[model samples]
Every structure is written in C-alpha cells, then in structure tokens.
Target chain A: MVEQHIASAFDRDLEAIQAQIMKMGGLVEAAIMDAARALETRDEELAQQVRQGDKAIDGLEELINEEAARVIAIRAPAAVDLRLVLSVMKISGNLERIGDYAKNIAKRTAVLAQGPNVSESAAAMRRMAREVELMLKDALDSYIQRDVELAQDVIARDRDVDQMYNALFREFLTFMMEDPRNITPCMHLHFIAKNVERMGDHVTSIAEQVVYLVTGDKPEDDRQKADTTSSVPQEV
Target chain B: MVEQHIASAFDRDLEAIQAQIMKMGGLVEAAIMDAARALETRDEELAQQVRQGDKAIDGLEELINEEAARVIAIRAPAAVDLRLVLSVMKISGNLERIGDYAKNIAKRTAVLAQGPNVSESAAAMRRMAREVELMLKDALDSYIQRDVELAQDVIARDRDVDQMYNALFREFLTFMMEDPRNITPCMHLHFIAKNVERMGDHVTSIAEQVVYLVTGDKPEDDRQKADTTSSVPQEV
Candidate 1:
C-alpha cells in the first residue's frame, strides 16, 4: 500500500508538469500562427499580440523547470521516470526558442510594414510557419500519447519546411538583383523566413526528444537535411 | 562512512562529466577560432578542418549525455548533485550548438570563397568570433570553478557582439547597394556574422547556466539585447 501511494503521488506530479508543458506548447503554437497571420495580412495588432504572448511562454518555461527540479529533488525518480522529467525540460526549452523566433518574426513584420510590400515572400513564409506550428502540435500530441508514429511524422515534415525556405531564398535573391530598392524589405523578409525555418528545426528536435522518451534511445538515422543550396548568388 | 562513500562516488561521476563538458567546450572554442581564421585567410583547408572537427564535438555531447544519464540512474542524486548533473548536460548542449554555429561559419566561408573577397568584413567577423570564443572559455572556467563574477562578465560581453553584428549588417547593405556583384558574397558574409553572433548568445546562455548552478537561482535580470538596429535601409 505504501509503495502504491508513493507511485501514485509521483505519477500525479509528472502529469501536472506534463499539463503545463502542453499549455506552454499551445501558447507557442498560437504565437507562430499569429506571427504568420500578421505578416501575411500586415496586422500590426496581431503582431503585437504575439510579442506580448512570449512573456507567458517564457514564464511557463521557468515554472516547468522549477517543477522538474522539484521532482528530481523529492521523487528521485528512476531511469524512465527521470528521462520523462528531463525530456519535458528539454522540450520546454525548445518551445521557448520557437516562441522567441515567432517574436522575432512579429518584430520584423512591424519593420517590414514601413517598407515596400513583399507580399509573395510573406505568403511563402506564412506557409512555412503554418507547417512548423502544426508539427509542434503533433509533437506535443505524440508526447502525451506516446505515439512514436506521430513523432516520426513530425520529424519527416521538417524537410518540407527546408525546401520552402530554399525556394524563398532564391526568390529573394532574384528580387534583390532586379531592384536595389527591394534590398531592405527583402533582407527583413529573408530573416523572418530563416527564423521560421529555424523554428521548424527546433520543433523537429522536440519530436526527436519524444521518440527518445518513448524508445529509450535516439533515432538511429540522423536528421536528413535537404538544404544544400548556399547563400551564393545564382546569377549576378 | 557508507553514506559518505556513495556521496564521493556521485562526486567522481559528476567530475568525469564536467571534464568532458570542458573538453567539448575547448573543441568548440577551437572550431570558432579556426573558422574565423579560415575566413580571414581564405584557407579552404582550415575551413574544412573546422567542419571535420564538429564530429568530435558531437561525439563528446553524446558521451557526456550518456555518462550523466548513467550517474542519474545509479545514484538518484539529491537536489544539489542532481542540479549539477542537469546543468552539465545543459552546458554540453549549448556547447554543441556553438560548435554547429562554427560549422555554419565554415560552410559559408567556402561559399564566399567562390565570390569576391570582402576582406574588411571578414576582419570584422573575425573580431566577433574571437570575442565569442573567449566568452565560451571563461564560461567553461566559471562552471569548473563556480565563479559567478566570470560568468556575469561573459554575459555582459554579448552586447558588444550584437553591436558588431549590427555594424556588419549595415556594411553589407552598403556593399550590396554600391555594386550588384557584391550581393552574393556579402549575403554569405552577413550570414556568417549572424552565426558568430548567435554563438555568442549560446555562450552567454552557458554563462547563465553557470550562475544558476552556483547561486541556486537564475540571474533575475533578463539578458539585455543590443541588436535593435535592423537591415532596413536608411533614408531609402
């Protein structure tokens, strides 16, 4: 009976922290979506909301870390249980980074507002950001359900984001080559594109962590990178 | 006496991981320097070496992680010891990221090789890389010695790196505006500079981890950002 009591208590503690992680992930997903929407629609207010929302995301990361630390201190969990807590911490850290990139996009959205409209580039970025946000959602679901297939699916989707980024990168180069006046706004748009692409990378990392949490080992195959094109100008 | 023996065993386990963390840090520092040197001197061989050295850095992260995991499983460490182990893992993650950024710089150096030589900008980026490498070394030292002052110093230096990046961002814009031919190489150099600045951010994060490990509390003040200036063209 005593052993059962301790096990239940620890399980409860783990569940509580897991709930907070999902909450943090939800906020991050919203931030990504909202940042993309603001960029696509040029909605300053929505961009501002994304920026303001990051404080909450940052707060959740701190709370999750504290809760995980508390669990380690008190529960002294064994191997799998400990990996659960550690992976939560790692996932939350990655979520916080994704949130920061979203905020970066929002910030650039405001600046790009002052310059000429790169509507086509904004549309491409919005698509990439949407893909990342969905991947993050699936990654969280995989964690909650211990579904390795879902996690693997999220990992596979990162390649699509990379291909989108490369296409947009080439397009931006062409825009700059044609018109020097397109330089500044194109630069801002490119940075936002890179930020979204990086956010996708972090989401992939979180998905990999989920697979590790379930399987007790990292994935055998390394992450496949589809980004071979360089910053080199294809035509001068 | 029996309890003390177990405690000493945990300490030795931690010491072993800490040593590996420092070793990873050293390799990362070397990668940063060599990448910068390769850029400045246009030495393809040295740049390629930096790329190859990343494998060793990645291997160390895996080793440090496995050792830390072994200790946590066997020892079930208490609050302080557990925090020490977790912090080492975090430090190693940050070190690996720094190594990756160095690899990115090296990769870009190769791309820039095929384009025109931007010696002035390479010199500037080299300076930024040097600052980040020094900060990373001190961060590792602070972790070993538990020196809060040194860690804080490292954190403070990140602003200078940001300023350098902003300066380069502007210079790259000017170059692109002056001659269309400079566009491709300047873009690559700017990306390399951004990567070095990001490496400094990771180094600062490692410093923050050291402060938390020693003081048992994260630094209350958030990291200051000095990279407010954007790639926006001035006065059109």
Candidate 2:
C-alpha cells in the first residue's frame, strides 16, 4: 500500500507538469497562427498581440521549469521518470523558441505593412507557416499519445518546409535583382522566411525528442537537407 | 557506512561525466581556433580538418548522453544530482552546435578560397572568432568551477561579437556596392561572419545554463541586444 501510494503521487506530479507543457503548446500554436495571419493580411493589431503575448509563453516556461525541478527534487524518479521530466523541459524550451520566431515574423510583417505587399510571396510564406504550425500540433499530440509514428511523420514534414523556404530564397533574389527598390523589403521578407524555416527545425527537434522518449534511439539521421542558400537557381 | 559509500559512488559518476564534458569542450575550442586560422590563412587543408574533426565531437556527445542516461537509470539520483546530469547534457548539446558552426565557417572559407582575397574582413573575423573562443573557454571553466559570475562574464562577451559582425556587415555591403565583382565573395564572407556571431549565441546559452545550475536562477534579463542588422551606422 505504501509503495502504491508513493507511485500515485509521483505520477500526479508528472501529469501536472505535462498539463503545463500542453497549455504552453496551445499558446505557441495560437501565436503561430496569429503571426501568419497577420503576415498574410497585414494586420498590425494582430501582430501587436503576438508580440505582447509572448511574455505569457515566457512566463509559462519558468513555471514548467520550476515544477520539473521540484518533481525531480522530491520524487527522485528512476530513469524513465527522469526522462519524462527532462524531455518536457526540453520541449517547452523548443516551444518558447518557436514562439519567438512567430514574434519575429510579426515584427517583419509590421515592417512590410507600410511598404508594398509582396502578396504572392507573402502567401507562399503563409503556407509555409501553416505547415510548421501543423507539425507543432502533431508533435505535441504525439507527446501526449506516446505515438512514435506521428512524431516521425511530423519530423518528415520539415523537409517540405525547407523546400518551400529554398524556393522563396530563389524568388527573393530574383525580386531584388529585378528592382533595386525591392532590396530592403525583400531582405526583411527573407529574414522572416528564414525565421519560419528555423521554427520548423525546432518543431522537428521536438518531434525527435518524442521519438527518443518512445524508443531509446534518436530519429534516423534526418534526410539530407536541400536548403543550401548558395546554390541559387540559374539566371538565364 | 552504506549511505557514505552510495554518496561517494554518486560523486564518482558525476565526476566521470564532468570529465567527458571537459574533453568535448577541448575539441570544440580547437575546432573554433582552427576554423578561424583557416579563414585567415586561406588554408583549405586546415578547413578540411575542422570538418572531419567534428565527427569525433558528435561521437563524444552520444557517449556523454549514454553515460548520463545510464547514471539516471541505475543511480536514481536525487533532485540536485539530476540537475547536474541534465546540465551536463545541455552543455554537451551546446558544444555540439558550436562545433557545427565552426564546420560551417570552414565550409564557407573553402568557398572563398577560389575568389579574390577579402583579407581585411577575414582578419577582422578571426579576431571576432577569437572573442567567442575565449568566451566558450570561460563558459566551460565556469561550468567546471560552478562560478556564476564567470558565466555571466561569458554571456556579456556575446555583444562584442555581435558588434563586430554588424561592422563587418556594413563593410560587406560597401564592398558589394563599390564593385559588382566583389558581390559573390563578400556574400560568402558575410555568411561566415554570421556563423561566428551565431557561435557566440550558443556560447552565451551555455553560460546561461551554468548560471542556472549554480544559482537555480537564469541570468536576469540579458542586456538588450543591439545587433539589429538594419541599424547600419551613419558615418559622421
């Protein structure tokens, strides 16, 4: 009876921290959508909301860290339990970075609001952001379900985001070469695109952690990346 | 007597893992300096060595991780012990990333080898890389000694690296504008300098982890970063 009671209490602590992480993920997911929508529609108010809202995400990270630390201190969990706590902390850190990237996209979107709308390319970026947002959702779901396949699926989607980013990189270069006026705005847009690409990487990492948790092995070496920036398409 | 023996065994485990982290740090430091020297001297052979040497650094990370997992599993460490294990894992991850950045710098230097010499900026970049190498050294020392102030000092040095990068950014822009022929090489140099700047960031992150491990508190809000790429300095 004593052993069973101690086990239950320890589990309750893990459940509570996991709940915190899910809550944090919800906020990050919302930020991703909001940032992308603001970019797509040039919504300054929405962009402002994302920038202001990141503080709450940052605050949740501190809380999750504290809870995880406290659980480690008091529970003195064995290998499996320690892995759970450590991974939750790591996933939360990744979510926080993803949120920062969302905020960065919003900042650039605001800069882009005043200038000409690179509407065609902006829409392409929006699609890229959507793909990453879905990946994050799947990554969090896999964590909750302990579903390795779902996590692997999320990891694989990252390549699509990378390909989209490379396409956008080529397009941006052409835009700048076509018009000197496009240089400043296109640079801003390119940086924003790069941030979105980086967010995909963090989500992929989160998924990789999920795989590591479910199975003792890391994800098979990620597919050879195709996002080499220097390999610009031929200018006929 | 039994309790004392267990405690000493735990200390041995901790010491063993710390030794591994220190060994990894040594390799990363050498990689950083070698990458910079290759860039300065335009030595493709030395660049190749940095690239090849990174595989050993990656191998060390896997070993450190496996050891950490084994300790957590078998020893069932208490909260303080768990913190030490987790922080060591985080430091190893940082060092791995620093190695990757060094390899990236080396790759770019190899590309620049075929182009006209941008010797002036390459020299400046070497100095910038030196600052980051020193910062990484201090960060690792602080980790080993558990010195929060030294860790904080390492964090502060990142701004200097960022400033150097911004100055180089301006210079690269000027070079490209002055001569269309200079565009390709300057772009390569710019990317290399950006890689060095990012290495400083990873070092800062490692120092932040050290501060957290020692004080149980992350460094209070890092000084506001001033590396806004658009803030091109106006000549007086």
Candidate 3:
C-alpha cells in the first residue's frame, strides 16, 4: 500500500513538472514570435516586453528543476521513471536556452530599431522565427503525447531553419559590400538571425530529448546541419 | 555489512565520474588553446585537429552523464551527494558547450586561413581565448577542491572576457568600414571572437555550479555583463 502511494505521488509530481514544461514552452514560443515581430515592426515596446518576459521563463525553469530534484530525492524513482525525470531536467534546460536566444534577439532588435532600416531582412527573420516557434510547439506536443514521429519531424525541420539563416547571412554580406552604411545594421541583423537559428537548434534538442524519453535510446547524431556560412568561400 | 559495501560502491562510482570530468576538462582546455593557436598562426592542420578532437570531449560527456544516471539509480544518493551528481551533469554540459565553441573557432579559423590575413585580430583573439582557458582551469580546480573563493574569482574574471569582446567588436566594425575587402574576414573573425566570449560565459557557468555545489545555493544573478555590442549605438 505504501509503495502504491509513493508511485501515485511520483506520477502526480511528474504530471505537475510536465505541466510546467508546457507553460514554459508556451512562454518561449511567444518570446520567439514577439521578438521577431518587434524586429519586423520596429516596435521597441514589444521588444522590451519580450526581454522582460524571459525572466518568467527563466524562473519557470528554476522551479521545474527544483521540483524535479525534490521528486527524485523523495521518491527514489527507478528505471523508466528515473529516465523521465532526467529528460525533464534536460528539456527545461533546453527551453531556458531557447528563451535566452529570444532575449538576445529582442536586445538586438532594440539596437537595430535605432539604425536605418535594413530592407526585407526583418520579415525574413520573422518567417524563420515562425518556423522555429511552430517546431517548438510540435516538440512540446510530442513530449506530452510521447509521439516519436512528431519529434523526428521537428528534428528534420531544423535544417530548414539553418538554410534560412545561411541565406540571411549571405544577404547581409551582400548588403554590407554594396553599402558601407548598411554594415552596422546588417551585422546586428545577422546576429539576430543567428540567434533565431540557435533557437531552432535548441528546439531540435528538446525534440531529441522526447525521442530519448520514448525509446530509451538517443537518436543517431547524424542530422546533416545546413548552416554553411562558416565554411562558405568569400565571394568578394 | 551489506549497506557498507553499497556505500563504498557508490563512492567508487562517484570517484570514477569525477575522474571523467577532469579528463573532459583537460581536453576542452587543450581544444581552446589549440583552436586559438591555429587562428593566430593560420594553421589549418592544427585547427582541423581541434575540430576532430571535440568528438572525444563529447564522448566523455556522454559517458559521464550515463555514469551519473547509473549512480543516481543504483546508489540513490541523498542531499549533498545528490547535489554532487546533479552538479556533475551541469558541469559536463557546460564543458560540452565550451568544447563546441572551440570547434566553432577552429572551423572559422580554417576558413580564415584561406583568406588574405586580417592584421592583429587573430592575435587579439588568441589573447581572449587564453584568458577563458585560464579561467576554465581555475574553475575546474575550484570544483575539485570545493574552493568557493576560486570559483568566485572565476566568476569575477568573466567580465574581463566580455570587455575584451566588446573591444574586438568595435575593432571589427572599424575594419569592415575601412575596406570592403576586409568585410568577409572581419565578419568571420567577429564570430570567432564572439565564440570565445561565449566560452567565457560557459566557464562562468561552470564556476557558478561550483559555487552552488559548495554552498547549496546559487550565487545572485546580478553579475553585470560587459558585452555591449548588441546594444551599442551605430557609429557609422
């Protein structure tokens, strides 16, 4: 009877932590979209909100971690239950990192708002951020549903985000080459683009965690990265 | 007698994991220095070595994490011991990230080696990387010794790394603005500098974990960041 009682308590604790994960995921997704939108619209107010909102996301991660530690300590969960706890900790860590990237995007957006408009890059960035946000939503859904296929799909989509970032990187370079005045703004935009790309990577990591949680095995680390800007030959 | 045996086994497991952490730390330190040296000397072969060597560092992290999970499951350490296990996981994560940054620096160095040399930036980057390497060494030492003072010192030194990054960012902007030919290389160099700056941040995180591991509380999150490139006003 006592074993059953403890098991139920663990279940309840796991559910609570999962709920917090979803809430944190929701906040991170909003941060991604709002930061991109702020850049697109040049709205410092919206950007500021995104920046401030990250604190809540960060706090949620801390809460989730503390709760996870408490559960592990008190319950002494074994095998699959233990794996679930570890995965939750990792997922929250990934979420926190994604939130940080969003904050970074907002910070850069505030700076870029003061500079001359770089044409079309902000909109491109919004589209990229949108894709990542959708991926994150699906990644969280996969976690909740324990759907391996959905998690795999999210992992596959990160390549597209990388490709988008590479395109922006090259475009920014061309703009800078064409106009010296464009250099500063383009550099900032490039970082914002890079930040969004990293968001996609972190979301991919969350999806990978889902896969690990379901299968008790990590997926092969053979996902082909599409970000080639670092290796691209200078055309200038 | 059986309980004592299990306790000794747990101690052995913990010791084995700590050994791995130290080994991982050593590889990461070498990676940082090798990547920086490659950049400073334009040594493509040395950079390639650093890139390939990261696999070992990554493999060790995976091993450490597996061992940690095993220890947690079999030993079910309580309180302080549990915190030690958790801190090991976090420290390995930080070390893994720092290794990735070193690989990134190497990747960029390989590309920059093929281009017309940008003057002085590579050497400056080497200096910045050297600082991070030293900080990481001290951070790990602090962890092993449970020396909170050394960890705190490592935390305080991260601001210096950030200030160095800010200086490099402005210098890169100046280089890019002065000549279109310098734009591509400077951008690559800028990213290498940013990667090193981020390495400092990860080292600080490792140090912070040391603090938490020793004190059972996180240090206040009030450490001021000195990297202002993202928010700096456009001077061009």
The numbered model that scores best in DockQ is 3
Best by TM-score: 3
The TM-score obtained by model 1 is 0.95
Clashing pairs in 3: none
DockQ of each: 0.48, 0.29, 0.71
Candidate 2 CAPRI level:
acceptable
| lDDT (Cα, 0-100) at A4 in candidate 1 | 87
Q: Which lDDT tens digits does candidate 1 get at residues B118-231?
A: 648888888899999888889888889999999999999999999999889888888888877777777777788889888988999889998898888777645668887552
On DockQ, who's better, 1 or 3? 3
- The residue-by-residue lDDT of candidate 2 on B1-236, one tens digit each, is 98888888989998999999999999999999999999899899999999899989999998998798777666767777878887888889889999988988887777777666854998999999999999999999999999989999998788899999988887876665565455556656777888899899889988999888888886665356756673332220
> What is the iRMSD in Å for candidate 2?
5.2
Q: Is candidate 1 or 3 superior in lDDT?
A: 3
Which stretches of model 3 miss by more than 4 angstroms? B1-8
lDDT of 2 by residue, A85-192 (tens): 879888998998999889878877777787776538888988999999999999999999999999999988988999999889778766655654555566667778
- Predicted candidate 3, C-alpha RMSD: 1.4
Pairs that collide, model 2:
none
Cα lDDT listed for each candidate? 0.86, 0.83, 0.92
Candidate ordering by DockQ (highest first): 3, 1, 2
| Model 1, span A18-106: residue lDDT tens | 99999999999999999999989989899999989999999999899889878877777787888888888889999999999999989
C-alpha lDDT (0 to 100) for residue A198 of candidate 2: 88
Query: After aligning candidate 3 to the native by TM-score, how far in Å is the CA of B224 from where it should be?
Result: 0.5
